[model samples]
Target: MKAFAQVFACLFCIALAGVSVAQDAASSTLTDAEQAFVDQMTESVLVGQFSVDGRSDRAPKPERYSIQSVTKTSDDNWIVQARITYGKYDLPVPVPVQVIWAGDTPVLQVTDLKIPLMGEGFTARVMFYKDRYAGSWYHGKVGGHMWGSIERQSPDEGSKTPESESSESDE
Candidate 1:
């Protein structure tokens, strides 16, 4: 049984590596327009950076629990730094996030259970322009199958998806 457990562990590790690679690839891809936006973002990063102010809710985010931090590491990868609030709570608590940038702007994939009623979830906003996705990152396993990463995104053409106010302008 010990050998069986060891083999299972090895298989799980290999599978995790595969998942990370796949996740990174999926997040980095972009549509022409999105790519344009990302390009602008990268340029802005070169110039310094912008900002993604505030925050909003994400619909049916792939995540299944409480959120930690939202980080945009690469043009394609975004990391959520936290552990699943319920289900099988892991030790050391890791940072879980939704990988974005591929075809869609990654949003908060989970809600904070600590919030009252609505959980006042992910009111945070992130605007990353340039970031180092290719580097050693914090990695851990969740649900015994999924993997998580913690990284940073450099901001460029800063944007806030959630706005506190709006102006009526004649078009």
Candidate 2:
């Protein structure tokens, strides 16, 4: 009976230690302010302009990106679930990116990150400030610049189409 009780105590201590490690691991990666910024940016839309390299004659129009969520995985990495629409292609994907902090500002850095269905050689370094964002993107041999304003979708606005959102921004 004494030996059995000793073994049970050792196992209990190990289980408690495991729980402590798991709790530490579950702690957030972002600071209070940084997490606040991320919370505000999520479930928002980015209205911006994207110009393809060597496409100088193309008219500049606003583009829309629907951000669903942003989850911090590590000290410098986050997973962003967003819907991106370009030309005839629309894709909703989760993109893992690195976040670099300049004071309180957060900049998302992607180096040669590839989306599964999308073409490879895709890279972007985007910075978010207040309600605005600007970035540069590279796709294979083509690259361009993009910047936009972050807009929160109203309850009614969420069900509306992107076209309607674009028009609302115009107004």
lDDT for each candidate structure:
0.26, 0.57
Error of 1 at 60 (Å): 13
lDDT of residue 166 for candidate 1: 14
Model 1 vs. true fold: TM:
0.21
Candidates' TM-scores? 0.21, 0.70
Off by over 4 Å in 2: 1-29, 84-92, 156-171
Report the number of the highest-lDDT candidate. 2
- Output the lDDT of residue 157, model 1: 15
